[model samples]
Target: MGENLHEIWLKDALVFLFAAGVLVPLMRRVGIPSVLGFLLAGLALGPFGMGALAERWPLLEHLTFADPVAAEPFAELGVLFLLFLLGTELSFEKLWSLRRMVFGAGGLQAMASVIAITAIVALVGAESHAALAIGLALALSSTAIVMQTLTEEKRAAGPVGRAALSVLLFQDMLVAPILILIGFLAQGQEANLFGALLEALVQGGVAVAVILLFGRFVLKDAFRMAARAGGRDFLMGLTLLVIVGGAVFTAAAGLSLALGAFLAGLLLGETEFKHQAEVDLEPFKGLLLGLFFMTVGIGLDLATIWSELGLVVAGLVMLLAVKAIIATVACRAFGVAAGHAIETAFLLAPASEFAFVVVTTATAVNVLDAPTATLVTGIAGLSMLLTPAMAHFGRRLAASVDKRAAGEAVAETFPDLRGHVVIAGFGRVGRTIARILDAEDADIVALERNPVIVARERKAGRKVYLGDASRPEILAQAGVAGASMFIVTVDDAKDAAAMVHAVRRMRSDLPVLARAQDAEHASLLYEAEAEFVIPDAVEAGLQLAGRALAEFGYSNEVLKDRIAVERSVEYQRAAAPPA
Candidate 1:
């Protein structure tokens, strides 16, 4: 039995990886977002597809997902990583800055969505408790999809993205109470639901306080100790420990595991280790998040969807309409721009992965019947599957509005920047590059779209303009046409690629030294005509190897020559087709 389980796991991993490795790039190349690709992959792996075949076809047994339930853990981790990354982006200072949006827009969106959906469900003759459970489950948007999309598109740190995130954060925080409410609604359960709620509150509060205290004190020092040990493995293990430990702790408190992981990230974001931690966890986050989306696909039932087509269609349309209305108004009230509010609404209208957990748990607790739970879950799944397209349409619709509102129509001027360096994005990496160049008295012009960041940097006397780096008009305004060099330092791969192409078109001979996220991204940038690409992973590896070799008594010249040879070989290997 153990050997069979192991074989099944191995086979499933290979299939999932193969799908991601092939389908993701294809989707990305064709301008379809990864969220949809993952969903499609999951559908192919599900019982209605491959799993059904595995039962009858001997030849294809090893290529199918034998047990869909086994993928759930990986899917859950993907969500935890999303929350963790979200938490890391939010420092206490940033959180304080967005307090109004968090409490105001977030609060209103959740309440309004729940109330509107509940009323609609009740009007359809459902029980009040079941209606409430269904409403709560469907009201939430897919955080994993939305966050991944926003982050990849360079919108997560933008106003619309932040507003959407604030609402999602509130939804995450509400999971515990909803679970307790489900317990109360449970049919034949004599358990003291309110008592259990109180118990949860007490335990949760205690657990949170302990985690905060420990992270604020012991964890930082522990991270330092781990770093002092000078082993990436140790640091990586500690990172996993922190994230998983928080998840376990939160689950123990009757809250969703994602809540605790978010808390841990929030705490760790305050530490110096945040950047390295992010680097180490990023690959896992991407792969696991893809797996999470695929599991979402597995949850869907094609036959049920076909049989209840009208109900499914109606449920999805109603949910989207209600959520968009609620979220748009909420965002506006919280001071988001009109176009941004609409974009935020669309980005968050799809039902979340948590909806599955909610519906399943509710059915198990007798708060909802199995059929009702399954139907609602189906609605949630379909809504999620359509999210990428909805987001794309919303973004296009808002583009003109955002442009007119921001007034990019009028011609713009820049400081004397003929032969100056063009720095796109004013985030951490860009800032570091600016500092280095500034110390050497290298003239630089930076392009950034975040109004707040631009305003703050301008106040600090930096030559930063409020503009999207991917736009030709913006690039022209920033004097990229005659700039001596272009440094594409944007953290987003898609944006970086666009920036590279834009720069290459304007100045084919100019050196465009771009920061590639990883090897794959480096290849994309290279294809985009970037003059030089330095992948972050490759650079880090070189640095570590150089230091280790020097410590092992190699002469400076020998180390330099050896490292250069390694760099040359790596680039050559990268240029070669895979065997």
Candidate 2:
């Protein structure tokens, strides 16, 4: 029996690899998001799909997952990596800066969602406890799906992305208490709900304190020691250890494992090796996340949906509407723009993986019946399946709103502007340039795709506007024709190149400057008619070498001359075409 189980595992591994390696790439070529691709693949291969006929068509057995639960452990690791990577992108200081949105918007969104959902469920004839359980289960959004979507769309660092993340963070904090409440409901009137909740919160607080303390004290030193061990393998192993160790610790404390991983990432992000950690774990995160999506797909019961098609569809629609409306209002109250608030609402409207856990527990304790649990789980799964599409639509809708707003503001903006800098992309690099230019009191008009950034920067009294720079109309609107210089500081290589090309088409004599990730990207930007292309990697190397020379007591002038010579040589080499 053990051998048989091992064989089944091997087949399942093959199936997972097939989806990640083959199906995903094909989906990408057709412009489908990888998250959806994995879901469809999982649906096609799970027991309810191809595996249901394995006995009649034995060959199908090797191509499908016989048991959905088998992949749950690895699926969970995917969630850990997702949260950990997100944490690595943030610092405690940045998190603190978002405290208002996190606590205010996040708290309101959660509370409102639960109350609204519970009332609706009760109105539909569910018992009070059962309705409450359903509300708690379905109120939250899928962290994995939403984060992955934002990351894929390059909006993870923007206002909407950060806003979504803040709400999700608060939701993570609520998981333990929600579970406790469900347990209390199961225990009937004899159980002390407040006491159980308070106890869980206390335990959770202790667990967080311990994790933070260890991270603050030991995390940096451990990473430093690993780096000093003279091999990347050591660093990689240590990273995995930290992720898994933190995850296990939190799980033992009756909290979410992903929360522990997120804390570990937050600590590691504060260390110098944060970038290396991200680079090492990226491949692992992608594959594991794909598997996680597949597990969600597997949990989807098509038969149940088909049997109760009308009810399931109505429930899904109602879930999205209530959550989206509440989330939008909550975000809007916290200063998010109307367009971006709507986008965030759509991004977070879907039910999350947490619903399965809540419903399953409620069923086990007799608070919810098996059919109700299955239906809720199915709704959650189907909602996740729709997340990518919803997010895409939200972006488009937001862009439309932003374009109209920009048009209305255009006549009063950039009036008779000439010899001013026209900057594309309002990200970190673009903002840095804006700061330096602002110091010089240079005339500048910046165009950005993210309305949230535009709103925030405008509130800070900068001339940032919402418009995609890749379009000729946006460039014209930004006064690029009369600009002294056009700067393309966007992080996306393709977008940067496109912006340069668009500028060159309209203003052939305009001096265009662009940012590139590497020499290859520099060459591409140059080919796109950018007169000046700064390769980040090459410049970083030059700066580090110059700093090293200074540390070695070299004269400042000598270091300067040496770095200049190297820079010229590197740029010239990069400019040349392939041999």
Candidate 3:
């Protein structure tokens, strides 16, 4: 009987791994978010679909093996690692730079959502404690799903993306306090509120102190030693040790493990070893995180969902609508323009994985009952499922809003700015270049596909022509024939190469400078007869190397020589005939 059980467990594990391997790539090819794909896979194999697999497969079920209720530690670990990576990507300086958006917009959204939802819950006859818990849970927007979707869409560095990130960062920071509050509410003690608050503060203070002292001072050196040992397994083990140990410590102090993992990430993020840690942990993080999302799918009870379909749908709509309104209002309050405010709101109107963490924690501590927790989790998950569609609609809404505002302006003819640099795709790179050229007193005209960005640029005194660059008619409209240079800085490599080709064909003697995201892209631009092809990654590496050398006491002259030598070698290789 034991042997049969072991065989069943092994088969379940194999089926899960196999399904994930197939579905993720298939989803990518079909232009769906991989998270959605994982969820769909789970649902298909779950009781809702074929139901061939066990209602609760043993091996997969082991992920949620805690006593009181099943707790998927590994799946939770995925959330931890995802947060860690996000924290590592964000530096203190960057956070400080976007303080207004990160704090003002994010803070307003969080507070407003909490208050509004709490009020709604109270109106619906829930107790104050449960209402607060539900409100906090609903306040979160999934950083993992939203960010991943944005990244896949190649908009992770755009205006909407940055705004979404800012709001998510604030939510992450707020999760720590929310976790403590949930713990207090769980105790259900009638002690002084102030005393409970004081206890929470002391516990939080100790956790922070330990993380700062031990994490920064001790863990860095420990990891350095492990890295130097040249044992891959040892380094991997150590990475796990730090994550699990930090989480265990924080959990013991009555805080969320995800918060502890985030803190651990921040600590490592500050060290010289951050990139190495990122590279080493990436595989484990990706696989485990996918598994985590899959478990969320598996844990979803189809029977309950069927029985409460209308309630679930109604709850999902209400939750998303409330979040969107709150976020939109908050963005406006922060002085973001109307169109951008709407986009920002829609992009962040879904409940985050952190919501699940909060809800699960609240339920564990008796702040919420099982059905309520399930309802909240299911709604949150559904919200995440709808995010891609929400984002697409948001962009469309922003576009329509922008067009309505520009009703008269669209008919106005732009001045013929000749002998100036014509920039295609006024995105991050294009806008930056435009700013520099404007500073240098060089006349410039920017062509952007996104009308929202074009409008913003025009409002900022930039002469942006709203059009696609790949088309010859648009290029002609921008005076590309007479321009001194054509700068192709679009995110799409194929588009950049096409623009280069069109420009070269139109005017063989005209110079075209193209920005490529990598070496392969640079080669494509080069083949298109671009006068200059700047590979962003190569330039970034050069800059990093120069900074490192300078920090190590190298003189400017030495650093210049080192850079020149590296460039010369690269140039020679580029100039070499194809093998």
Candidate 4:
């Protein structure tokens, strides 16, 4: 039995890697989210179809090498890395800057959603404890799925995207306490509730103290030393160690590993190495996240779904509808435009991955039975599958709403255009480029589809247009043809490439400078014949090398030569035809 388990584990890893290699590219070609593909692959190899694998194997089920839990530490590691990355993206300063959105809007959404869902569950005849647990679980949106989709759609830095991220971040921070509350509520006994509550408060206090101390003093020096070591592999390893170590420490203190990871990331985010940390962790983050999603697929029991098909479908629809309506209401209350409010609600209507964690924990604590847990999990999974479709539906709904409110001509025109460089996005990379361009006396005609960003940018005295750049009419109205240079700074490589193609057709000789956020994007831009393809990673590497050389007392000429050699090599590699 041991040997069979080992063999199956190895086979599964290989199959997973192979499938990922194929599925990611195919999904990209089809304009589908890679999450959908990952889930589909799991369904294909899982009990639903081939039945070639089980959800768990004895030797492969450890949290760490020696731990006995069936869920590997890597599964937790995936969540840790995700939270870490999220933290890196958000700093305390930035969080404070957006306090109203982060706390006011985000807090209201969480509170309202939980209350609304709790009521619905109770109305459906669930026990109070079960109803509360379900409501809490449903209140949390999938930060992983929502953020990933927004990123893939090139909307992450947009107003709507930032607003979504802020809400998700608040929800993530809320998860730790919420989990503790569920545990207490599940116990039901007065003594147990009091004891649990006391323990939780103490644990939460300690965790906060540790994070504050680490962030204020220790992490900065530690990362500084690591940065000076100048070894890429070492840096990557150190990053994983911090994430895992933080998670372990948090778990030991009775907190969620995901929360620990997030806190660790938040601390690191305050340091200079934040961007580099994001770069170092990319490969591992992607692979583990993919594996985590695939594992989710593998764990799904098709037999159960087949037996409870109607219940499962009904649960999924009900969850989506309720969440969507609640979210839409919340967004409107926060003053989002009707169209954007609907889009925001739809984008977040699906149940989050965190729901699985909540439901599973509730079941373990006896607040929810196995059947209830399974039902919630299946519904959550189905909601994830429907997320992209819901986003599209919301957009259509928004457009319809807009058309009815104003004439088509008024609705079609993206207002307030002057001297603005018309950046189609405001993502990290896009915003960076925009800042640089803004510094160079260029007025930005920022055209962003995310309503939140559109509002924010408009307030900042920059003209922002709320419309898609790929639409020729949208582009024309943004003065793309007449603009200085059309900058394609969207996160989606395919979309960026398509926009470039469209721009070229419209203005044959226009200079289109694009942000190649990664090697894959750079290659795509090169193929698309973009005038200037800025490989963000390669540029960061060059900057690091230049600074290191200077610190080593190298002459200016020597440093220049070093940079030239690196550039020449990169250019040669970039220009080489794909294998």
Candidate No. with top TM-score? 2
Q: Judge candidate 2 at residue 511 and give its lDDT.
A: 91
lDDT tens digits, residue span 316-415, model 3: 8888899999999888787676677788789798887777778889988888999888888888777776787888899899877755544433334343
Query: What TM-score does candidate 2 reach?
Result: 0.83
Please list the C-alpha lDDT of all candidates, in the order they appear. 0.83, 0.89, 0.76, 0.74
Q: Give per-residue CA lDDT, model 2, range 175-277, as digits (tens).
A: 8888889888977798888887888888888988999999999888888888887899999899899999998888777788888998999999998989998
Clash count for each candidate, listed in order shown: 0, 0, 4, 12
Tell me, what's the RMSD of every candidate?
7.4, 4.6, 7.2, 7.7
Per-residue lDDT over 444-527 for candidate 4, one digit per residue giving the tens place of the 0 to 100 score: 776565556666766887666566676676677777756767788887788888888877778777777888767677777777
Report the Cα lDDT for candidate 4. Answer: 0.74
Worst 10 residues of 1 by lDDT: 404-413
| Weakest lDDT window of 10 consecutive positions for candidate 2 | 407-416
Clashes of 4: 12
**Per-model TM values vs. the true structure:** 0.72, 0.83, 0.73, 0.70
